[model samples]
Target chain A: MAPPEVHHLFHHPIADHSFSADRGTLAVARENNVELYGKTGGKFQLKDELRGHDKTVTGVDIAPNSGKIVTCSQDRNAYVWEPSPQGWKPTLVLLRINRAATCVRWAPSETKFAVGSGARLIPVCYFEEEDNWWVSKHLKKPIRSTITTVAWHPNSVLLAAGSTDGHARVFSSFIKGVDARPEPSPWGERLPFNTVCGEYLNNTAGWVHSVAFSPSGDALAFAAHDSTVTVVYPSAADQPPKAVLSISTQVLPFMSLIWSSESEIIAAGYDCEAYRLQGSEQGWQLAGSLEAAKGRPGLQDQREESALNMFRQMDLKGKSSDDTKLKTVHQNTISTIRSYEESGGVVKKLSTTGVDGRAVIWTL
Target chain B: MAAVNWRTINIDALDPDSPANFDLTSLAPAVAPVSTADVQSLAGHIRQLLRGGDSEGALRGALENPPYGADERGKDVHLATIIEILQSIRQSEMSPILSRIYQSDGGTEALDVLMKYVYKGMGHSSSATATKQITPQATGFSQVHGRGGSEGGGQAMSVLLSWHEKLVEIAGPGCIVRTMSDRRVV
Candidate 1:
């Protein structure tokens, strides 16, 4: 295996990041603006910056087919940026909630998107052809607290959301005109808008941090603050789930996760490393960490302490030096992990951005 | 009748965070109600297990079924028994016992329940110090306080803190977060 490719963009935390379909353009949420970097000369160079948001931009997602970028911010708003010949044009999305938008993701179909917010609601927004503007239908019932993350099913009709109230719910975001009626699945049959197909609470009632649907869309996986990843398989429309496998770990809680395939999930969080979890409806378990455990240089260097090095270190800082850097690739919490490249329902590469301000591309 | 002015209704006044809407207790896992008598019997059994040098069994017994439906006094009695068992175990035995419990069935939940007791014990120890300061006469009747009551209290607190550290090492910081967020009373 080759080492992961690291890109040190800046010293600021990247709340979210997305790569375009062609893998030529990258959009990252930095502070109050979304920076667009284009691949140039075998490197990602600053191509443009979308500067419309007035508050900390929380999320940014690029539609793979349309190349349209959607961004949400703490200022309680979201914007859709369309690439034109001259430049990217911005259009505001009418998310009527009064609280900040926490996350946004373009549906697989690219015709709609869902925005999770600090308010106890999720707004599934789609473009209105007659009105020529993006309008939102709110999913409000049964949500008691702010939503932390939202993921769209493969069919673009079913949506999964994790909330601070400790519930990971699957709801129908089906729009009458925008989305074609999806085939009946275990989630539901009459997929009307705002229909909640399933709701699951973590065993410890820990606040759910991130949620993702399996590639097949038949299973839902969520990472909660309890350092546990729970996988739920729906049995039928309005019945008990077939299985609810909760894989608890003795590590820090996962902040974000992505399904690399139907049976494998890659999660990253405060541990400053990505971990692989593999299992199925029978059971699931933590396989191990993705990063190979390496011997620490600090430990090796401590054994060979020399007088010349000690004096140099003492003269430089007036005290003996200690290793301040972490042993992992990310020095801080990894906030987002996305499938960079996929083929035949299996992810070939993954990209992750973190508070350490480094975007790393890892090939699997 | 005049048309109702819905615009001036102050929708935010109906706060979603109200007690009715945010009833955290409802999220607790449903368990068969345990009475005070049952808790007392279980505590006695746990004490017997501890006497037989089965500390792991004692710990598991204490954590397996917390008195979720019992009164405050009943729960406190059970909590004191658990603290006694926790303090009796040797420091060297702590990690081994925790690892064994962690690997067993429903081990994560057992650890979570133990974390709740650890936090509650810490809270009681701190509050004991506060009451001793505010009302010195309260400790006058107790013979232990006449010599080194505060010292003993401090020692117990240190023990609880060490247990907390060990628990975190085995269960990760998620245990602390779960204990803090859990609304179920032990």
Candidate 2:
């Protein structure tokens, strides 16, 4: 319609923001709490606050078909919560592991989700009949080190997890009627249709914090703490990902990466500015930068009582007690960018969460 | 002799109950019966009296004396509920009511009340000898202090209802007894 207006709904100053595929809604995993936002009119409205993590939450993702949200914290527990019609209430607390989950992603179908902890990547599938969830058998490789990000392919068939070692391996779960190849392993398990691959991409020594795939299923984009965004193209021609786009820029460590719908542009969210890339030769440029609210240099430079007071004064009303208060549990500026491709392709939407405690929804 | 002394001066001796020219409502809490300790204390005392074969005397004393517990900002039904509940628990002889009351308000206020009641009730007594005070533990009442077995039967309902009535009575008929256990209660 209008080339999608970019609006930064909020600027909460924290550490980071993690987003989901349905850009209409965003769940931010902050240091203390997780926040959910819904797109209303042309802006993002605070929809829910999911609490109870003993420490800072590191990642968040929303399940499909419903508003069920999953978040992982440094406190070593990952919880799955459902938003109540009345407010943002936690429905169920899923698993509480003894390790911190740095990254999380829900499968394209939303039936299951995955998490990255230390050097291990754990994929948990929800069993409706059992009313429980179990870790996927395919992810039993025991990588032996820290995994920074986990991303499920759009086809819901492959899952790619990246780590500090600069290796991003793709795995296939081989659901029935899919990947029915004969058993290849010693146990006749056909190796589960899952394979591991690694590459020593130049200058990828630091932790790979973000992993994403092009909407077309052709290319995979990853950003590492090395301050580089690396795009991987399939070596084959049948829908092969051609051309590796590596853009190096000196901003805050590259926290997250995403590809535009057409796969023509790549967006990397930095600490201050969001970088956009056309290709390696063209290099990377700042797409959009968040400017502090006019009055002060800090988060709430104007003499407001508190962030909560500022939020209350905005007349922000949600489904709960004083939902208007801006004092959200998770306060952080967004260091990530993503877009949702609607069914009819009529609308392409963009949403973001940041450390400043703001979730902005953009119309594309 | 008294008349001569009055002339000599007795400004310090003022009539205690003389009709005061000031209203004292300002010195009082907006409502009464809000304290857990007060309700528990009154409940405990009445419970003791009822257990000591003074049920009729205790009820009569409560009706006449009307001891509102620790909180002075609650309604009259709080007192009523305390009296009613003590009477029920004494007659039922069920100890699980403490658990019910403890969990009734999510255990916030009820536990406080139950804790004080149990502590004071069983603090001094012993069942082995008449000379020794009967303690809850000495009476072989382990259910009251066990981790999961503390729900005391109908006594829980009495405690809750008593609290509800007291809040309504003191804070006005519309006053709701919000258990300390639940922040959502208004």
Candidate 3:
């Protein structure tokens, strides 16, 4: 495998990041603003900044087809940035959420988006052509706590959300005039707004951190605070699931996860390393860490150290060894993992941003 | 009547995260409550299993039906039996026994119950040391010649900590989280 490409953009943490369809532009949520970085001379260079939110920006996602950027912030606000001749223009969305918005994701069709918020509800926003504004309808029933993450199904109608209440729920976000009637699937046939298609609680009832749908939209997987990843295959609309496989690992809890294909999921979080889990409805197990084994830099320094150097180091810093750096590529918690490139429903490369202010691209 | 100003109504205030909104007792699983006599008999059975060199059976008996609904004294009695069984097992046999227990039916719940007792035991031992500190001065002159009592306490504490670590290795941190969040006492 080739070495991962690392980009240290700044010192501050990156809460989230998204790449444009052509992968030429990157939108990152940094502190209170969203920074747009364009590929210039094979490197990402800051091109513009969108400053509107008063608090920390939590999420940023770009529509794959329309090239539109949607960002959510802790200020209980979200904005849709549309590119124009002058510059990128911002249009405030009527989320109608009182608490901070935690995550945002655009539907595959680009006609709508979902914003997960701390207000114990999700506001599915769509364009209102006659009103000349973006309006939202809330999915409020049965959500007992703040939503931590949200994912869009392939059909763009069914939405999956993970919440602090330890439930990963799938709700139909179908709008009357916005979305076409989706084909019947295992989730449900009569899709209505706020129709809870499935509600699954983790085995230990730990806080759900992230959720994702398979490429076919037939399966759902969620990572919880118990360091367990559970996969659910719904048999039908209202029946018991065919299988619920829980894969527990002896690692720190995952904060974010993405499905690489129908049977493989890549998750990263407090461990600062992405781990791959591969299986089907029958079972799932942790394949291994995606990080390649590399010798530690500190080990080399210790090998080169001598008695004189040890005494000099003790005199200077009163410590025999310098252990500030970590062994892994990422130094802190990996906050977000996005599919950098994919073809034929199989992700080839992944991009991850960490609290250490570095965005790394890894090839599978 | 004047038209109501809905925009200024503060919708969040209507659905605040108040204590009344959460019914924690509802989270407990429905199980038959255990009595003091039931706990004493089960403890006796576990001790018999341990005496017969069936440590695994003793562990299973101790973990199978934790006194989730028993009184504090009853639960403590059962916990003591469990701690004794845990201490009697050899380090080399811990992993195999844990793996077998995990593969059995209702094993996850049993492990969760064990984890709860392990944590409670650690808490008691630590608090016991705290109280020991206060009484040590009173008995300092008598114990200055021999520090065996405190050393034994420290060794027991280490044993409990290692058991906690081994339980996490086998059951994952989910067991600990579940035990902490579960409202039912053991």
lDDT of 3 by residue, A145-187 (tens): 8999999999999999998878899999999989999999999
**Residue range A160-233, candidate 2, lDDT tens digits:** 77775555555655555423353332112233444453232423244566777666655677776545567776
Q: Write the per-residue lDDT of candidate 1 for residues A185-263, one digit (tens) a residue.
A: 9998998888999999876778899999999999999999888899999999899999999988877899999999999
Candidate 3 residues lying further than 4 Å off, grouped into runs, are A295-303, A314-319, B1-19, B25-39, B64-74, B91-113, B135-153, B165-186
Backbone collision tally, model 2? 56
Ranked by TM-score, the better of candidates 2 and 3 is 3
Clashes of 3: 0
Q: Quick one: best lDDT, which candidate?
A: 1
Candidate 2 C-alpha RMSD relative to the actual structure:
29.7
Question: Each model's C-alpha lDDT?
Answer: 0.88, 0.50, 0.87
Docking class of 3: acceptable
lDDT of 3 by residue, B1-186 (tens): 258887787654565563246664443345567898999999999999999999999999899878877888888899888989988998778878888998887777778888888888888777766555554345766465334445656777778788787888888765776676555667
**Model 1 lDDT, full chain set:** 0.88
